[model samples]
Every structure is written in C-alpha cells, then in structure tokens.
Target: MKTTLTVLLIIQLYGLASCAIKQHYFINQMKTWDEARQYCRTNYHNLSTFINEIEKQQFLQDAVNQTSDAWIGLNKPSGTWKWTTGEVTTQISWDTGEPDNDFCAYLHKDSKKLHDRDCSNTQTFFCMKVTVNTVMVQQSESWEGALEYCRHHHDDLASLSSSRSMTDALSKITGAQTQYVWIGLRFLAGGWFWISGDDLILNVWSSAGPPQCPAQNQRCAALDKNTQTWTPRDCEEKLNFLCFK
Candidate 1:
C-alpha cells in the first residue's frame, strides 16, 4: 500500500476554549530582581510576563499594590530583552523616557507602567503560575497549514523549549486523533528551531539522535503521543497540532 500526502486547510474553531493563561500573584516583600525571580521560581512558575495589553492591565489590576515598585519577568540579559519563559519581549508597555541604562524592568505602582531599573534594586514583585500552556486542535492539517492556522488564531505552534513545557504540552494532547501531533519544531536554515524563538536546548528526541540533514520532505517535527518524544515527519502529513496561546 502506498501512503499519499494530503494538504488540509482547517477553519478556525471558535467554539473550542482557548488555552489557559498564567495566573499572577503579588508578593509584597521587598527583594532585588534576582531574589524576586528566585522566589517566583521556587513558589510559582516564574516572574510575571504579559503578552498583550489586556493581560497587562489584568495583571496590574490584580497584582499591583501602592506600597512598592514590582519586578516583572522582563530583563535584558545579553542586550536583548526577553521573558523568563524564553520568549523575546515584543509587546512592551514602557513608560515614557524609560529603559535608560538599566537591564531589569519593574512596574510602577502609581503610573501602572514598566520602567527599567537595576537588577539589584529592592522591590516587590509579581509571579505567575502557568496552568495549561497550549491547546490541542483536533483538526488535522499539514505542517504548513497547522503553522498558518496557529499563527492566525493564537500564538505560534507550541514549542516545548523546556522539560516543564514538554510536560505541559504532553498534557494537552491526550485527545488527539493522530498518533503524532505537529509541534512548532522545524528544520530550517541548516538547524532545527522553534517558531516561538526559544532555544532548542532541551532534548526530548526519541532513541534516534537529531537528524543532521533530514530528507527535504521530512523537515517538520511531531510528538509521538505514546513516547512523548519528538520525531521528524513529512511536512505534508496531516496531523492534529498544538498551539501556544
């Protein structure tokens, strides 16, 4: 029997519930940015990161207090601003005339805006607890079609950049119709990369080591539902996909 590749473009399913967002918490204790981050990591997921204006406003409304400035997850570690989740900061809400010479960002209690400060500056902070990080779309689509649908409807296709993220992604795919589900991993420009811009540092590949040079058609990655490991597959093989939100 010969297997044929099929390209299926799926329509957006509006009725499906979106992926769970992070839950923010306010800690009133004064601590440096590093201290705050450690506390958040020890207790919750990480320092709070906002992806949009609505999320920012909701976090501020719930987590901001009048007593002190608050450290968030935004920081410039190597001259590039990034969230602790490994995603680069793009939709920022910096205060006017801010981010001068500083590497860490803190939320102003009064202004409700982000201002850059020294990492050593003592302040209260916000932390977030991520519940479900991605949503499994049951609709089957090719790798390119899945990427397009995910980018159009939510964030990029899910990127299991860490062990915890891989666990989170695994939890969402129990109901997938396909044996393997499409992820954001792709072989491109001579290397494998995540569409969300996270480093492919965590190795969850199966027994087979990373493919040095995959076949032209076998450039997309999918997660084996039983093994919970990543494997390269034909880009045209339609499968249910996970989308980060």
Candidate 2:
C-alpha cells in the first residue's frame, strides 16, 4: 500500500509539472487591437505564437471563460497574413471556410472559433506576459514617418511572435487613450504586404476579400477606419509609429 501511494504521488507531481509547461497566459483586462499588439511586443518577444491546433483550441477554451476577447498574433498587412513575430503561419485550425478577407480578425466566443475583424473596431484583448528586456528609441515623425525612421536606423518595425510576448508588451504600455502605435505593417501594392517584403502565406482577409488600392501610386499603408484592415493609404497621412532598439 505504501509503495502504491508513493507512485500515485509521483504521478500527480508529474501531471502538475506538465500543466505548468503548457499553461495559458492571458491579460486581466481588454484593449484595442493595435494597443493589444503593442502591449505584447513591449514586454514579450511578440504576440503569442500558437504552436498547433491543440494549443489554439486550449487558448480559445480558456479565453471563452474569461471576460475579454483575446488577441492573437495574426494580422493582415498588404493582404499578406503574418504574425506579429515575423514568423510565417504553418498550421491553421480556422473554422470551415474561415478567414474571409474583410478587415479584422476576431475570436467568436459562442463558436469558440477565430474570425477576421476590422482594424479600427475596438475589442478586448488577451496578452501573455513574459520577462524580457526591451529598449525603445524616440523619433519625431508621424506613424509612416516612424516606419521610415526605423528602416533607416534598425531592421523593420517590431514583430510579435507569440501570444505571451504580445500580452507582455501590451501590459508595459497600458493606459491613456493614445496608446496605439504603428508597426512594421502597412498595405502596399494591391495585396497586403510587409516592410521586409516577407510573403504572407497565411491569409485572413475579410469576407469581401482585401481592399483594392485606391490608386496605382498608393505604395504606403494604413488601417482604414471604415474597413479595419490595412488599406493602401497615403503614407504622408499623420499617424503614430512604434520604434524598437
């Protein structure tokens, strides 16, 4: 009996450790899509990176029970789908016939599924906080200007790789109404593309598909308030941009 009890105790301990290894991290509050993206980038490496279908399912299950709609690291810039962490999407478990290009990406609580959302539409975000040292440099330029500034100084704008990283970045710069900052993302050409010219293999455009460039000369991108997805806007338009060291 004593040996059996010891074995059971060991098994229980092992189970606990396994749970910790795969624990889901989430923010306690809600935030806008841009704000949430920045939040994750500042503290963590990037937005939370979903490993596989099981991890994605577990995140949805945990978020459904929570108050806020969690933010995943998915974004469509220039009609190209990529994670904030600069990693190309490999595995996707979207609902049958999902990621219809509209504007934004969201998670449906009732269905426990993911959907595209408008960039401007505000929603609650879930961030996974992690420990990392990040450095921010100041630049005097508009959002698009800042992107140019980063290109001149360092690599492209910051990228979100994981969900925990996204949460951590969001937590660091919480508060104030003007929390949204520009990322390396922008809509260029007719398709949603990135600053680094990385091809977006994972597409999550809204139902109407991606928005067409207003003009042939439109090379810059911005989040259109009307659509919420990255649209080819005049880069000269005034907006906020985020720079990383």
Candidate 3:
C-alpha cells in the first residue's frame, strides 16, 4: 500500500510540473546591444521582454550564476522606452532618475536594477523565443473563434499585461450592452501570464501577481463590472477583443 501511495504522489507531482510554458536561451558571451539583438533574432527570439515581477524575477534567477550585466529587449532610440514585445513600456520602476543615458537598457550585475547605456556598449545579453503565437483580423471574434482566426490570420488571442492596460482594452468594447470581451489570460504551471500575465496595481490585491490561481475552466480574462478588476472566464465565451496594429 505504501508503494502504491508513493507512485500516486509521484504521478501527481509530475502532472503539476507539466505545462505549455516555453523556455528562452541566455547567452553569456558579451556583445553590443545591437549585436546581441541580431544574434538573438538569428538564433532565438528577440532580447528578453519581461511584463511583470514574475518574469523579472525569473529572468534574474536564470542569471544567478552570471558574472556580468546583460542587454534586455528595451531601447529608447527616440527618447521613449519600447519593448520588443510591441507593448509600450509604462510599468518599469526607474532607478533614481534613470534612463540618464538614452540608448539601451540592461540588468545591472550587482544591483539587479535597470540602467540605460549607450547602444554601442558591449554586454552579455539574454535571448529568448517569442512564444505568444498567432494572429487575426481586426473584427469581432469569440475567444475560441478568435484563437482560431488568429492562428489562421497570423495573430494570437490578445493579452493585457497589467490592470492599467485593462482600461485601454476596455475602450475597444464599443457598446455598454456588450457584456465583456476576451483577453489572453491563461493559467498553466502554477502561474498567470498575459497572453496570461497581470500585475494588479490596485489596492484590492496585496501582491502584484494574481491573488489566486483561477479555476480550471476560468482560463480566459474579462473586466469585472463592479470593481474594474480583471477576472478569468471560460475561453469558449464570445466577447470583443483588442489587438495590436
């Protein structure tokens, strides 16, 4: 009986460990910001783009054994920050009037904070693959239908990265009669990401991450009417969607 119970426990643990999460490759060799970007694009995805504390922590943790700073996917070419993920970066914690230089962003080796350097500065960089796959037309689509349409049209279902962006997505829903639209909020491997990610900035949730793991069926997200918060819903449900240009 004990042996049987041990086998059952092992099965449960293995099941919990499995998910659709994709991993990215990190290179230790130092190179300039543009060189690093070229290398990452040729070999893997763009430089790393982190949406929240979870991703930030994961990126840092992956480099726990590293010995130098690294270039990320953020750049201020025209005096504004832009993430390679195509999302406008509005959620970064600046370090004491940072971006003091306006070229590239890198994770500081010792501080773990961000600092901008000249684009030509050579540094080790993190490279990762773009996993949020697919595309669709700029029209009304159900969650599943949208997923299908996106896959067919070279778009993927939409994902809002934070609570603030929730309002931006909400603006796309034209009529009040339209109950709610689908946003790319998925649950896998014990965490949430925007394609399923959110850092709740409101006072309602104590932490930046989701307050709790959503129910199994509640794998998609929509705005909550009362508190203006985002909550997970069934993916099969039809709703308005927001997409990038």
Report every candidate's CA lDDT.
0.79, 0.48, 0.58
For model 1, how does the per-residue alpha-carbon lDDT over 3-101 read when each residue is reduced to its tens digit?
222212212321123354778988989999999987887677678887666777778777745467889999999999887766666768889998799
Q: What is the TM-score of each candidate against the true structure?
A: 0.67, 0.40, 0.48
Ordered list by lDDT, greatest first: 1, 3, 2
Note the clash tally of each candidate. Answer: 0, 43, 11
Candidate 3: stretches off by over 4 Å: 1-24, 132-245
Per-residue lDDT of candidate 2, residues 1-245 (tens digit): 53344235323321111111233456655676777777755554345545456666666655656555556667777776665545446665566678887545656656656677777766666554333322243333454456556546754453323444234334433331223444444443245554433234323232354455545434444332233334444445454444434
Q: Higher TM-score: candidate 1 or 3?
A: 1
Error of 3 at 140 (Å): 14
Error of 1 at 185 (Å): 2.2
lDDT accuracy of residue 90 in candidate 2: 66
Which of the numbered candidates is closest to the native, going by highest TM-score? Answer: 1
